[model samples]
Target: MAKFEILSLITSLLAIFVSCLALYRSRKTHSELVEFEKVHVKLSRRQIEEYEAKDAARQKTTLGAKLIDSGGIRLQVSNLGEASAKDIWIRIEDPDSYNPLVSGDYKQKIPYPSLNPGEDFTLTAFIPLSVTQQVYPIALRWLNEDGTQGDFRCTVSR
Candidate 1:
């Protein structure tokens, strides 16, 4: 009876030691996983902020037009981005086959070279007096400071 009790005690001790070892390994792995998640979260946040900044910069540019008293119209392009845009060019697309009567060239790309932030460029042209509304498909392209190219397509209504 004494020998049997001693064997049982040894078995219990062995089982307890194995359980403790498994618990220690599990905790260590859990801590490592948490650390990896922290790094992933940091990287994700940085990418999101970069995209937001680019979107904000793109939204800063605007195209507008106004009718003048001399039977002509003035078209204006404004850049409200925080940084300057380089290699700026504009293209007018006639998708609907509606021809516009203008004195200046519309088929060629109008180059502005560099438009600083918060700057405006105005062009004056004689639009047809008969048309009440006109839709112009304007394509604006520019290069950012980081050598990233951006192209925007918008329609101007007058």
Candidate 2:
């Protein structure tokens, strides 16, 4: 009887340890995401400056994304680029962190094409997520011309 009790105690402790480990891992992952978002935000700002440096040619390029309309789970990204693009590549990430929300061309640039220096463009597509929360991290990577690239980010939900 004493041996049985001891075994039970040991089993309980092991379970507790495993649960603690899982919790620790989850927190670590989420915190890493938060840190990445911060760093990316800074990098995106720097990119804006780089994109504007070409303004000397009287060319002004700007990129922005917003939730324009939602159909239950769908979302529209407005003002992704300025002109009709030959091609565009987009990456959507976890709003709470830097983790990517989807893999591959999450948002097709074909719908938006290329945005000119100041032309406006919009993309209406489904959000590749089931998350119902109203706020999260979003990151985008865009290439306007041949070698001209831009990055934009936002924290939003709808």
Candidate 3:
């Protein structure tokens, strides 16, 4: 009878130990999954291109013309993740220095608005000739479809 009582006590403790180990593993797995989800909605700058115009007739002669009367800048923003992003907005940090030709609405906020997984958005603007071969600071803000907000600091070169 005493042997039977001791066996019951040992089995109960073993069961509790197993339950605690399972709980710990469950919590750890949940934490890992949350971190993995964060990587599923990342956004990044994919490309930047600059275009310049030349004086007619001289256009063929001077491929490296310093005098650019008109020019433009193009930027490609891409979502390199598995989830969709929403409420996307972009802002140029120094408008006075770079002088990108932007409308009043754009000055307030260039809204890409939304991007799906593996999707991209191209933003082009006519910029001053002076805005060439320089790096401009930019701010990008967005929200994941799961309501997680994200902000990224980026630079654009033209």
Q: Go through the candidates in order and give the C-alpha RMSD of each one to the true structure.
A: 6.1, 24.7, 18.1
User: Which residue runs of candidate 3 sit more than 4 Å off their true CA positions?
Assistant: 1-72, 104-109
Tens-place lDDT per residue, model 1, 55-147, is: 776644433333233455655667766667777776566655443435364423266677777787666545567766567676778877667
TM-score of candidate 1 to 2 decimals: 0.53
Q: How would you encode candidate 3's per-residue C-alpha lDDT over 21-120 as one tens digit per residue? A: 9999999999999887766533211111112222222122100001122344555677765566677777676767664535664545456666777677
Distance from true location, Cα of 22 in model 2, Å = 93
1-158: candidate 2 lDDT, tens digit per residue:
69999999999999999999999999999999999999999999999887776552233234555555534333344443334333444445754443323323344344345555445544444444564556656665665454566567776565
TM-score of 2: 0.40
Best-first order by lDDT? 1, 3, 2
Off by over 4 Å in 1: 1-72, 95-109
Better structure of 1 and 2 per TM-score = 1
Clashes per candidate (backbone, < 3 Å) = 0, 10, 0
- List pairs with backbone clashes in candidate 3: none
TM-score of 3: 0.47
- My TM-score estimates for the predictions, one after another, are 0.53, 0.40, 0.47
Clash pairs, candidate 2, are 82-115, 82-116, 83-114, 83-115, 83-116, 84-114, 85-113, 85-114, 95-136, 95-137
